[model samples]
Target: MEQAFSGRRVLVVDDNADAAELVGEVMSLHGHDVVVAHGGKAALAAAATFLPDVVFLDIGMPDMDGYEVACALRRDPSFDTARIVALTAWGDLASRARAVACGFDGHLVKPAMLDSLINEAALAR
Candidate 1:
């Protein structure tokens, strides 16, 4: 299938270098303009420049958690409408509920298939 994520601006926030790269590569392959950040601080800085349509945030980060990042992003009027999807290893219903409460537009478990990632990104758009 032709990727549904084409031409979309996506921000990938993950502390794991390999994971970050993998996510960026996946989105790029699907024709998204992907920008990556190693932490929440960097992610916040990148947002201004990236102007991403959607943010894929890993919940477990050392410096700053995804919840903080999502909340901060939501506070900004410009990013208020931007989609914030929690990209984490947590797949349980409780985790999903927590993510929703933390302001995530959606929840995606780790090691997501390429099609699933693209589909999620499409929904965010």
Candidate 2:
């Protein structure tokens, strides 16, 4: 797809490097500056420095789940303007509701379609 997010910054957090990189590449293709973090702690650390416009956070991780990370990010004033999107394999309504409760701005099921994902990213912008 053609780039639509030139100059934008996006953070991607996933334990699976391949999945994270795939999303990162897609964001990069859209001209966004993509930062990939392998876990919740790393993701938060990167957020402090990257100050991304949007964050794609995975629900499952070693140190912390996406819920904790989302709560933390929501509490941080630095990330107040950043859009937090839950990215997980769990696609059920319950999981999505949990993501919302945790302060995620949006929820994306794993293996998301490129168009829908890109659309959500654009909506965040």
If scored against the real structure, what TM-score would every candidate get?
A: 0.91, 0.92
Candidate 2 Cα outliers beyond 4 Å, as residue runs: 1-4
Candidate 1 residue runs with Cα over 4 Å from true position:
none
* Per-residue C-alpha lDDT of model 2 across residues 11-116, encoded as one tens digit per residue: 9999999999999998888888899999999998999999998899999898989999999998999887888888899889888888889889888887888987
lDDT of 1 at 80: 73
lDDT of 2: 0.87
